[model samples]
Target: MSSFVLVDRPVPEVAVVTLNRPDRMNAMAFDVMVPVRDALVELSNDNSVRAVVLTGAGEGFCSGADQENAGRAPHVEGLGRPGFGLRSLELLEDVVLALRRLHQPVIAAVNGAAIGGGLCLALACDLRIASSTAYFRAAGINNGLTASELGLSFLLPRAVGSTRAADIMLTGRDVGAEEAERIGLVSRVEDPVVDAAVEMGQRIAGFSQPGIELTKRSLHAGMAASSLESYMPSEGLGQLYLRLLTDNFEEATAARKQGRAPQFRDGR
Candidate 1:
C-alpha cells in the first residue's frame, strides 16, 4: 500500500510488484522494503494470483541500502544503537524469508544494478531474468564490510556455486547480464526484462495451483535436504498427493488427445 511499492495485475493471474523510487535507483531503504515484504505477503494470501514478478521502476533495479538516507527502520524508534541495528537487520531478513515463504512463485526482473542487499533480494525470488543492461555486485566488501547482508552469504553460494560466489563476493566486482546468465545467476538475459518475467509468470499461472505450489515447496526443500535419499521421498509424496487429489493428469491426457491445452480447472 505504500507509494514506494506498486502492485499491478498485468495478466489474468500474474501480479507485478514494482519498486517505485527511480531517483535513488530504488534503494533498499526501510520505507521501500517494508512495504515490499507486506505486498508479497498480501499476494501470497490472494488465491486469485498464481505468480508474481518483482522489478524496479527505472534503469537500476536497486542500489542496495540507501547511503544518503535509509529512512527509519520500522518499529525500532526507541531502541539503543546496537538493538536498533539488530532489529533493522531482522526486518530485511523478514523480506528475504517472505519471498521464499510465499505460496506463489516469484520472478525477479533485474532491470539494472542489483548491488549488496539488492543482489540478495533478487536471489530470494524463485526465478530471475535480467535486462541486457543489468548488472550485479557483492558490494559490501567494496564498502569495507563483509559481503553477507540479507542472506547473501547463504544464498549466493547455492546460486552460483561456492568457488564463484567466493570470487564475486571477495572481489566486489560487477557481474553483467551475459556473465550473470552464463554463471547461472540469472535464468536468462533479455531486453525489457520485466516483460520477459511477466511472460514467464503467465506461463506458470496456466498450471494447476496446487501443482505449482507443491513443486515450489519441493524445490526449496531440495535446497536444504541433507541428501538425495532424504529428499526424493518428499518430492514423490507431493506428486502423489496432487495426482490422487485432482483429476489434472487425466484432464491433461484428454486435452492432449483432443489437441487442446489442459484446462487445469480441477485445482482452481
Candidate 2:
C-alpha cells in the first residue's frame, strides 16, 4: 500500500509530492516521513524530473509531528535513552535531509499552517511560496519541547539571520504570511499557493539541467564558506568548466542572436 505522501507529475519535468494526512494536519509521523524520503530519493534519480513542488492536502500544510503517535516504537532500535522524542527526531530529521540533498530545486508550497517540523520542511526547500492564509510557528517550544528540531536552528538562521531566528525560536510565536515575506522567509504570497510554486517550478525546469544542478551545489557550498574570496574560486571553476565543456552556452548565444528560446540538450 502507498504511504501518506502522494507523488505525481503535474507538468513536464516537475514532480509534486503532497502530504496526504489532512485529518492529522499532514503530521510528520513515521509512515509519512519514510515515504516522503523515498519519494524525494526516487525523484532525484529520475533524469526526466528537473524540479519538485512539495505541499499538503486540504487546509494545513503540516502541523509538525503527530503527538498522538508519540508513544510509538523508536525510529532506531539501538538507543532507548532519548525515548520517544529521539524516535520522532530520527524520522523528522531524515525527511529534512532528503529534501536538502535533492539535486533538483524544491519549491515549498505552504498553503496553511506550517508548524514546528513542518516549518523545518519548508526551510529545507530551495524556495518557498505561501498563501495569504498561511502561517508559521516554532510550536514545539510552546509544547515544552526544543524549538530547533529537524534542522530548524541551522536553516532558520541562514535564511533570516541569527537575530530573527533566535527571537522566533525563543518565543514560539506565529509568523503570518505577510510578515514571512517581508522578512525574506518566503518569496511570494498568493491565494492559491501550490499554483504559484508550480509556475516557479516550470520556470526553473526550463533552464539547462546541468547548470541548475551545479548552481544549487555552489550556493550550498557558499553557505559554509569562510569568506567571499574563498567561495569565488568554486564559482569561477564551475563557470569555466560549463562554458568550455557544455554546448548549452553556445546554444544560448545562437538562440539570442536568432531571437528564440534555446533548447537544452536531453538529460543535460
TM-score of each: 0.98, 0.93
Q: Candidate 1, which segments miss by more than 4 Å at Cα?
A: none
Clashes of 1: 0
Residue range with the least summed lDDT across 10 consecutive positions in model 2: 70-79
lDDT of 1 by residue, 1-268 (tens): 9999999998979999999999999999999999999999999999999999999998899999899999999788789999999998899999999999999999999999998889999999999999999999999999999988888988999999999999999999999999999999999998879899999998998899999998899888898899999789998889898888889999999999999999886554
What stretches of model 2 exceed 4 Å from their correct place? 1-3, 70-88, 266-268
Clashing pairs in 1: none
Candidate 2 lDDT over 1-268, as tens digits, reads 1458999888988899999988899987777777788899989999889999999998999999787873344446666667655666666677888888898999999999999989999999999999999999998799998897878898999998899999999999999999999999999897788888888989998988888999889878898899998789889998888888778878889999999999977335
| The 10-residue segment with the lowest total lDDT in model 1 | 259-268
Displacement of the residue 113 alpha carbon in candidate 2, Å: 0.5
Looking at model 2, how many pairs of residues clash? Answer: 0
Task: Name the best candidate (by lDDT).
Answer: 1
RMSD of 2: 2.0
